[model samples]
Target: MDPQTDSQAADGGRVLIDHAHEGHFGARLRAAREARGYTIEACGQALRLPVRLIRQLEAGEYGGIDYQVYLSGYLTKYGRHVGVDEEAIQAELARLAPRQRQPDLVVTGGVSHSRYLLERYVTAATYVVLTAIIVVPMVWLGVRGTLDRDMPRLAPLDASPVAQQDAPATSSTSAAAVASATQPQAATPAETRPEDQQPVLASMAMFPPLDHSAARTPLATSAAAPAAAATGQGGHELTLNLPSASWVEVTDATGQRLEYGILPAGTQKSYHSDSTLDVRIGNAGGAQATLDGQAVQLDGFRRANVARFRVDIRDGKAAPVSY
Candidate 1:
């Protein structure tokens, strides 16, 4: 609703300088809120913003898609609350805010269905795969055991010795029993092959082969091993990008200064280290960070007014070091 203009003295009377630039919009907001005797909380309550975000805005910390794109509206609301010139604030912000926040939704929104499926199901499928690896082999082995112990072994009637053949003058029931003992029937086509001293169950090929050692590995355990390997020292890089202006500081574990400067809007900088990196950002709203080429959360940086944290890579494991 309202915004900012330069104030000055003309002919000993207070005058609002129309076209003058008042540097750091944050300072303008802070001065106006203070002049009204309103705490940051009271101003935020009136403006419907969290107290921390109000503090960040007053500190000139705006970053990220949410912050940068919506910041103009926030400024308008803030202007209304403080009774500044809305039109003037919008004009200044138009000149100040970069177009980086208006991300191309069409480009990023086109996520491949295959990739989406992989992301959703890959982890769950690992458990199923690991389970099948263990269970399938056990099932096949149990089947083999039943085939060996329960299934009758059959030999041709001619395979019997001459003495046993000559001694058979049995009754009809005994003859039928003898015939059954000599002849075996197969229940399924999988077991229909003749077994006359050939290899045990000539076709165990119906079941998939099992990898005993691989089956023993739990999916969680195997996945953890790779994560640890990823964390080891060497080739660790910390990158910071500021879509909007923010104050930042960085130091290494060896206490070597890397970056201790105010980042201008719409620029990026990086530092390399072998151990840990300590980072402090005065304005965290739109800051993005990467550690070892992986996106890492700024962890309460944006809303906290100022964010400070440490990143550590040890024994092939990368983790945040809490401050």
Candidate 2:
């Protein structure tokens, strides 16, 4: 052969060898992946690519994805994951120049596509339901708390009419007893005849009218009124004053609840108990108490801004006992 012919034959032989060496790059990758016991899905997951993308790549189809830098990177990663040499994959990618196809479109009647859509909608609806279940009760409880805090104060019950009518008569009789006891006795007579004293005693017993003005004297009445009012008719009076809003509970000795609930700022309440009063105060620092006109010191009994104590009434005197 001549020199030019020999050079042309050498070039043709080199081209053929290169084409043979780079033959079926995708097929080689698939064989390598399978030999390593990796499924297409596993290889896709390992390389962080979609299963469809992995399938298209192994089938030697370069559709759906951008073919420039992205395809090269994906192939390099997938080849490395499947134990294929990176440099060989890159060289094949450069030489093959795979043709690009149009991206696959979703068909309306496709089963897998419909299932995927349904799953996404179901997941979103589940999230919404869970959020409502968590948030709705919290909102309702908050509103209920606000309404309770702003509730109106209830009026105390009225006293019986019988007690009201008898109060004045009892006070007047007590005053007469006090007046008679305080008055001095007249000097006793030196001598008396039984016959003469009998007529005077008989006449006095028949008439039996005493002076009302003397018995109900202003001095005696004034002294008795305060003593009667301080210790109420059937019980001792207890007064509670709140400087700020606080919760209060009062129970009598009979286990009857007298007052129970929150008291607003500047609120004053009175309770009557014949034997004892059990009291609990929330926000102790803002509350003041009085029993039978005597101030009760609550600071000593406070714990965590709450105070609990019992009031005992004996012989018309009130004393507090801490609990």
Candidate 3:
């Protein structure tokens, strides 16, 4: 019999062969090979097959060959040429192969092309579903881990030193001397003594009480009002009275700027608030103001809103301020 006539027909009881699909597969294989600019001989070299065998396979007339085995290798080789998934193409070929009582005598009417079409579709959908199932959870886990890692640490606030304004100053120097003392010296490390050593107090000095005749006034007593609650947030505003130009920045509770600008001399800048403020009176030549009417004693650090002694910023430097 002529090899062409022996092949299954597209219709009738010849066999359940899909001529159109077979042709499409052949066209794709041919296009894939040619797209790489490879001739049939070059393709055969890659597959370790003769050029005649490759040409017969592309013509869809390799009846003498094991169609399943031959197509599997052919699809794999062609796939590499075009970067398509070889397994997916092999699966398509397996689904298209005729199934029957005997491979040689496949009965056409008993097979359903529609069933194979559905099977191919289901296989593709399963791959898509499996990919989504695997990838989505990984993405969610990455985001959740980032959020867990980024949460801010607040433990330091509870451990900070407290600043109590009502506490008496440790030094008895005049307020003028205190104001002039711009920097507080850090206390020397405490000297360790023997267990039997007794502590000693330093010598004391006293000044006579000021004469009240010049400023004598009737002693009036009024009950003090209850203290205001702390806002638990600290920030400051500065108004600069400069002879020339001066710029200053006031930071908020978190040491971030709440306001910043420039002003001229004798400009009564009022920065009055019941909050912890970070003031930077920058580039001013010998300037001063009444911080709540008591001279602006540019001394010791102020703590942050959350802590007692952590100053966020100072006159010209940054320090932790605590309340």
Candidate 4:
């Protein structure tokens, strides 16, 4: 038998093998998609399907997918987009169908062995576009603000320090006479204390009672509002607190990536952002967030589930915003 004809089919219920076509039927569909000027990413975007799924359908690699019904839909969409008639592809998939029995209704599975689609979303091109849209205004404000703060102020030319330093070095005689006049006269013997009679105070008398309030630092940082609330005139303060392990990524409205790492238990970090704060958590149940000081509720979020939130920071700490 030809090697291609003897090729193996996926084990899962996801795909059916059509030994009759020799598994090379994908060649035509691949050519058609390319002819339409759609790359894998563009095709996935336009079809609202994942790239891995498309690749699998093309290569007949369905061992990773868990759902048969979804595969049917993929086949349907793939045929429609590439001008493959429904009848022909259906016959092929039908010949490749799982043996023994089939379900009346197929439900999409929650997980997949293939993680390509997950990684795809992580590096989506949309993120770059979104970052550009958010950063332009922040860059303008930051530059303008820096210039205003650093601009030099001019002083009168006549008041230059050079003029003061050049004042004819006063005659030495006059300077000595002025110094003598400003100095204290030597004390007479009667007016001076004896060498052994220096004034002294008991240890208790040395220091007055301490006033705790008076010694506080004038520039110390303090909470701006009640612990449960925070106010922002231009933006918001974002904080992420992890009571358990979680992977997180954060980007400020200015498109600056603040952090992206796996946070261990008991880890907490804070940031201030203008406009929006973009966050991604690999384990939503293990992560908690706050806007300003107001707590964000993540009660419904599940473990091992990824969640993305885009918070628009506005004036004041409004109700916890989520995407």
When sorted by lDDT, best at the front, the candidate numbers are 2, 1, 4, 3
- Backbone clash total for model 4 is 2
What order do you get sorting by TM-score, best first? 2, 1, 4, 3
Q: Which stretches of candidate 1 lie over 4 Å from their true place?
A: 1-234, 301-303
Model 4 CA lDDT for position 272: 64
Cα RMSD for candidate 1?
41.5
Model 3 segments beyond 4 Å from truth? 1-16, 99-323
Candidate 2: residue 143 Cα off by (Å): 29
Evaluate all candidate structures by whole-model CA lDDT and list the values in order. Answer: 0.58, 0.62, 0.45, 0.56
| TM-score of candidate 4 against the unseen true structure | 0.26
Which digits, one per residue and each the tens of the lDDT, describe model 2 over residues 90-163?
66565544334357997686569889999999999999999999999999999987765654422111111212
Residue 270 error for model 2, in Å?
Answer: 0.9
| Model 4 spans with C-alpha error above 4 angstroms | 1-235, 300-304, 318-320
* Clashes per candidate (backbone, < 3 Å): 12, 0, 21, 2
By lDDT, who's the top model here?
2
lDDT score, residue 99, model 4? 34
Better of 2 and 3 by lDDT: 2
